[model samples]
Target: MKGKALFLFWTLLIGFIFSTNGTLVYALESPNTDNYQKDSSYFFIQYNGEEKEVIVNGNITLKLTGWADDSKTTVNGNITSVDSSNSTEDITLKVNEELNELPLNETEIINYRIIVADIFKSEIVTTQELTDSSTIVVQNNNGTSIEEVKTVDEYDTVIENKGLIYYSSGQSGEKLVITKEKYDSLNIVKDTTTIESNAVSEVKATPTTKSIKEVQPLTRFSKSSTPATTTTVANKVPSITYSTHIQKIGWQEAVRDGALSGTEGEAKRLEAIKISLENTPYSGGLTYTTHVQKYGWMSNVPAGSISGTTGEGKRVEAIQIKLTGEMATHYDVYYRVHAQTFGWLGWAKNGESSGTSGLAKRLEAIEIVLVKKGEQAPGSSERRYITPTSVVYTTHVQTYGWLQPVKDGAMSGTSGQAKRLEAIKINLENLPYSGGITYSTHVQSYGWINEVSNGQVSGTSGQAKRLEAIKINLTGDIAKYYDVYYRVHSQTFGWLGWAKNGMKAGTEGLGKRLEAIEIKLVLKGQSVSVSATQAFKEPLKVFLDPGHGGNDPGAVAGGYQEANINLAVANKAKALLVAQGYKVYMSRSDDTYVSLLDRSQKANDLKADLFISIHVNSTGSGTTSANGIESYFYEYNPDYPSKINEDMHNNSDRIKKSVTLTNLIQDNMIQYTGANDRGTDGSAFSVIREAAMPATLIELGFINNTNERQKLVTSSYQQKLAKAISDGVVEYFRIY
Candidate 1:
């Protein structure tokens, strides 16, 4: 137990030492033998691209780099020195920046126990009988006879003789011997053997043999009761070889027959690829194309040529592969890719697209295989390459302010409240291409503001300026594949005609405010059913009556007639409402006297939404001190003893709505004109009481007061009154 423990300890120590110095070793034990003898058997192997010989029991230091595994199947290093003495000296080597594992080919191995450097790894075996050959013998320190095996054909052979000896060595300089029975039991056949180091090449002589048969190199060994059987064929089997150029890493070593060539789980993009056919008897080759980033699908290229961009930092988003000529008839090429967001996608065959197209995703890894015609596929062949596109938007409204964003043809602002959209922001979602959505807005005071892109604000926020018109468009690949359509709900127009791809969407010079907007991103050549002509809503009809016009001159003071001042203010208010996209009607446009009952009848017949009678406050004598603005809405008073119409009596709903309108107009008139606030009250005026809709009477500053009448008669003060009344009407509709 102590001896075993000590052996284990020393073995571990030596392994640690070698590993620290970047050396890998695989050790196999040979059978024990008592007889010690010096043997002249040697191994012939390729060293530094040259064939060399190494004798048994010879010690050498080998310098190698890029060591991969215990088997050393893939190596990019070579032997730098050779020695015959049993000296314990450290060997040094240079390492490659990126070490890769590669498959082996022919011509890598020829005989037993030989280490080949800078070449693929393989082993050869043969089945033959030894006869009529010279035998060489040697004597060890004990003077015992050591029989030497003779060289046969270049291939390894299986002998039928008994009592044959096989020899091997270990680190402690111990010899291992294999008896004939053990050799036969091993059932050694033609198999692959990899040279692990740039060590001394040890070649054992092949015994003389007759009736020798050839076999292919072995890639892996498996246990069997008998030797592996092989049948001769007339043609070589066809195979596919491929390599990938990856991000950060350059082109990797090639792999064959459906082996993986690119990295998985590394987040590296496959930028380019080279694919070719090997060992094929057909006359034609393969062709492929790639969908690249920024530059869509590239042109087709022949096999072994690059089908995508390299060194430009572009990603391969998709690929299509197919065969040509006789090869196409004999086989079908199938492939799948590991995409950026989708992971391993379904297989694609015969030139169908394999990865995503417009999604702007990258290909990370890939696997390819060829099947004979009508053979079962490796996986499902359903193509999956779709990306959804949409537009999102938000609006700052007159009173509601910035509402939450809406998406894809949904309304972003208020609809029927007559609120103006003050500001806007827009963005595109899942737009699987380059560039972004850009938009420009025509504002009330600032026309055609510079364009803003992708969720940026395009209209005024806190300034209370309305977005009168807008233009939307896309850039780069987004423009190439998609069209942006938008329509607006203006104050009077309701919904205007649909505009597309940078066309004007709302009224520009007419000064109409956009109330609501709907935006959509449609694929090119697809039809979306949006209103292409004005889908007019019933406009908010307002009836404005200039009180006591024409035949009856209203209260006159300081040479200013109340009738003329009322007419001027009403006309100005009509013009302002018209610009705001409202439908305004006046009982007297040019001071033609209309009775109070006739005025209310005209407004009711028109089915107006609101009614306001413009007038001036008065005291019969010019000496009165009464001054300021006031408004009145009607409510029924049973004690008044005057017979009232049914629409005017006990109509609580109309009274409440009229009161709201009266207060709004009264407050705005005082605010704009800086007049004394006489506030609002309920009255039984004939025009307001008999009106069917919400009705109010607004009184300008007192006409009998010299100071107030002086200001009211001026054109500037009249214009201010018009603006105040129009704004109050707008505010009323915004709330109710």
Candidate 2:
């Protein structure tokens, strides 16, 4: 598989979404996939007035359209979305001429519900009739009744000689209208008509019955009359009822992230809704993520909305308003729509507000805008609102994500250290703002760059324009040059900044453009790179020193020998590392006595990069309860220079990795062999103090603790103990 010309894909967080040839990437880069912030998503069907109320059942045909983010691919999954703003209505005229049935008034509707049994909740997506909110009919005792319906956009019906017994398949308050001409078999002998109204009717009888019976089909838009009519299916949980109204219309809140919509909590049960909605994602059909930040949840907020009863929907029994200017270092607001008014709402920070009681004296909406990477939109660090506009109007719009498309080419540097500066120039040829991947050289850990199209030599090129930065002290290993990514959009679609390295999958074309820039180098001979990766070729070697020896026991614990344990465990690990081609040497292979000086001599003789020593554990309490494993490195003590040198090894973060590995091993071993995790220790022991390379020593279990001592005496325990130590070594390196 080596020479197959494999493509190196590095698509990262949010921005492109293109799915082609059945190769779809389910996970699109969203702004906050990590923090769970998402872009827009959801498929929608544009409805005509006659098709508003659709009752879903068997034989339903469906086709829909949706949106995707800036990615070229996305994974397939259930679609989650709010109900569409527009709705359609379906009315049917079913009549038995012999029965002489009467028609319904224009403003009125008659309902005949049929409770179908054994309907599976999942099959609704495949069933055709179930997809349409309008078309619905229920089988009744005598004949089929009106099933379901919705108002096309907004409808105001004119009721005639009314006989309205509204029917609903499953939706709440939705209904379909029936006509008298359809049911002409029944006669109106009473002076007053049933469900009478001033609208058109299908019945040929003069208005007589004055009783107006109202039955809003469980799903129709408009006031409904009370009735005990209902349809219950077997073995199915009630389908969650949802509405297109602004208030809490569904069983759950839609957007549950602070930065995206400000509503916070566990990721909404989006997968459930997506399954219900025919695999369409809800948030405006966006495939990529938007951004991320630490967040809280609407875990306490129920999915339903309050009645705008003014004050005290602050749910719970108390109201606490906190207004402090001290916001957490990382805090973002989430958003959602209120069911009562269908308005947006969001989560707030613990300590951020207006005017001070000591803080700003007001509550504010949270809005943020960031231009996506690989895009030409001018990236805004944060959002700024027009102060003059009404504030409460946009409290927490559950409707949209704060996404701004790329506008133009941001600049880079002066083509200093880039491997192929020539490609940078070619990349800018047809770009709206010609700024040939302009970039300067960077020698420091921290750096900056300007927008390429805004390629000014000063402010836009250096540390001042570092659009994004990470905290890794990198010394340029795999990448030879930094290629900035640009986007294609309307007026401002062009260059942005250094291709956030590997931002999207199969980005060879972008890399090819980056390889085209030609730079003028005045080198007298060959190019001299400051990052000299070519300087060293020797393999890193490490000498393992299992502290103490035969004649001299390091630390007397219980009745066990620490020196014997150290050498035995170290030898087992030596075999493992050497098997993987790592050169290793041990201070003393046998139980024969050896001095600390001699151990360092062997390590220094081999020019090792690391030295590790093993030992046994014990406790001063001398109590049976006192037990556990402990790892020791050098202790940082300002009083001694050796202390500082060993502290250097302990503080390098490598030891922490060692400690974690040790703890895991000891914990597992303790569980299996009845030993205990005494935890790890980083201290300055003599072996740690004088090692030439980074070093550490580990203590197995306490022999002083009688229980552990007895356990240590068995060959089975010893072998398990040896395996644990070896495991810790391998984990510490994250290599073997």
Candidate 3:
């Protein structure tokens, strides 16, 4: 008994040393090994664009720099005499001398360490397997990439066109220069409003006296109002004036408001265009589209905006625009484009534009659109209410089929009720909107239910089932101009992933219970004022602790190490959680020792929503009979401060949460691993008791059990266990 106690003490002492120092101190007996022989390996030194190949027998010295960009420290020398800025440094490469004598199927690596200087004092160690002509990049000891950082400046746009002329305001009826040549012909005006005793002040024109008729025939756009005198009231008509910069013509005459200005039949391209609007008060507002050289049609832009590329070198071919929404019915939109030789052909209304199809003619200059309020639709013979611009929807919920329909942007499903949705429908009232609705739902027990289109039923009406999630998108013509963004409020992981366009947005696997949803639609660059009220909730942020690592290998038996198994399973679980978009973190990603306090502290610091410590069970020698999987959790105490929830008092919420998690994991362990059921139990384990959030410690089964130990180490069994744990976590979130 005394000898056994002494042996245990020594084992613990070795473990402590291994933990403090960066090394492994094994207490187990060494396995038998065969003699090995020296082996030759090849490698290439690579830096920037330079490369050198060589064979290494035992050790080789490399000339290196502090950083790849610092060429001042370059020097070559053998191991001990490295030409570093600091004192002499040493590098050593170690390999099994008799590797050739080992079995051919065995794998081995050569280990090397370098005492680096220059940036700081440090040692770098790494292992490399013997390979033929492998490229080795010499880098800093701190593992930072030695490449120089590149900085990019923000982009700025500059405009410089000789076609744009500047003018000044003078007296009413005074002639205004409209062309560059005409402006240059005058005593070039330097300052229009500035005046001083000795300064040569230039006269400017005001609205009443300004006569903008000095422009030549090519630059003069309007034939309507010609050099209006103060005597005659100026005729001001609502209009849109535009000018296009052609490939060769530079800038042609600016088109009169509401008139076509550019050539149409020529095979030239319109390089750039500028538009200006006046006197229209349509609520829908004005926007235009442009077809560029390579990129087809670009999105619409507001009036007085620039379209088509200038210095970018692209040309505008075809174009379209519209007065959207209320303005769509109020005004008729018109536009026309310039072509190579055909000057100002016929005008196109609405979204139409006149331009050559396959002809390579450039659109030199272009005139802008003119919006004219159309006469009210001839009074209908029979009285009818105005049509709505959007569609409304409603869902027939479980136990309550066929609810009243709601308006656009309103909630069609129930929230905080836990009630399931059975069927749903939408209405456009047969009013043409150039599109139809297509939607899919995730229902209880059924992953993603069949998709429904228009006003068709998405889920079964008679079935007493719950609706988990839903996705909605537009189809047909209107879809080309609109986008939808939808989100769901679920029982677990509330307010799950947001789905845009036609992508699935809510939880699918593990059957999360969806409580409410909010759907919205908007035109590009515009805000949707839709609002749907529902109970809001936060998402789960879980932290996984892979217990025991590095020197502190837990419960080793049957040639299996507990720490290794724990890390493997925890990593797998984390991956599964991440794939589902759950925020997750692991206590240890490598074989490194971590204190129990530190593990719990990490969860507290991260304010993790859930904390789970993964470990393996083991009995003393000759006690392998203790098998099966179990989960342990700390009893909730109000006196303890909750890091995840500040409002959490001595309430039973933590206890309930922990127990749910424990039972879920334990049940899944048994179901997936087919191990004996040990059930969930309460405990004050350090990892659980100190955790501020709902926490659980799971013992995945005894490594000492002969049969279970064999199954525990297998990759397939680990993956199954991982999947089960992930499923349990999802279930816990779903319910709580």
Tell me the number of clashing residue pairs for each predicted model: 8, 176, 30
Worst 10 residues of 1 by lDDT: 28-37
Candidate 3 to native Cα RMSD, angstroms = 27.8
- Over 4 Å off, model 2: 1-525, 528-540, 555-560, 597-601, 620-625, 643-674
Ranking by lDDT: 1, 3, 2
Winner of 1 and 2 under lDDT: 1
Tens-digit per-residue lDDT, 402-492, candidate 2? 1122222322222222222111111222221112333322112223333232222312222221112111110131122223332211111
User: Per-residue CA lDDT of candidate 1, range 1-736, in tens?
Assistant: 4433433453354331232123332111221111101121112222232222221111222333443443333233333223443333332222221111111112111112223233322222222323212121221222121233322222221111222234333356454565534433444423212322111111233233332111111111211244223321125578998888786565677788778878899877898887878766565678888998767888887665666754345678899999997779989998999987567888888898888866556898888999989899998765444455779999999988889999989999988898999989999887556789999998998888999999999988778899888889999887887889998888766888788888778876566789999998877756665553343233578999999988888888878788999999999999999887788999988867898889888998998889999999898875569989999998676654223347444478878989999998888888888999998998888888778889999899899898898899899999999999899899988887
Every model's Cα RMSD, please? Answer: 25.8, 27.8, 27.8
Worst 10 residues of 3 by lDDT: 151-160
lDDT of 3 by residue, 1-736 (tens): 4433543454454342221123222231111111111121111111221222111111222323323222212223222222342333332221111111111112222222121111221121111211111011111121211111111001101111112233433466333334434443453435433322111111111224322223121111222334434343234345666766554344445575656555555544576565544543433455677776555677666554446754343557667766665456756666555454344445566676545443333455555555546643222212111122365677877666777777646676677677656666654443323677789887777767778887888776676776766778888755664567667667645665456667665555545655555565555444433333222222458899999998999888977799999999999999998887678988889999999878878888888989999998898674477788889988555555445334432246776788889888888888987888988888757778777778889988889998888888988888988888899898997786
Residue 331 error for model 1, in Å? 1.3
What TM-score against the true fold does each predicted structure earn? 0.32, 0.27, 0.33
Deviation of model 2 at 45, angstroms: 66
Off by over 4 Å in 3: 1-252, 255-392, 398-409, 426-435, 445-447, 476-481, 509-513, 522-736
Reference-based lDDT, residue 191, model 2: 28
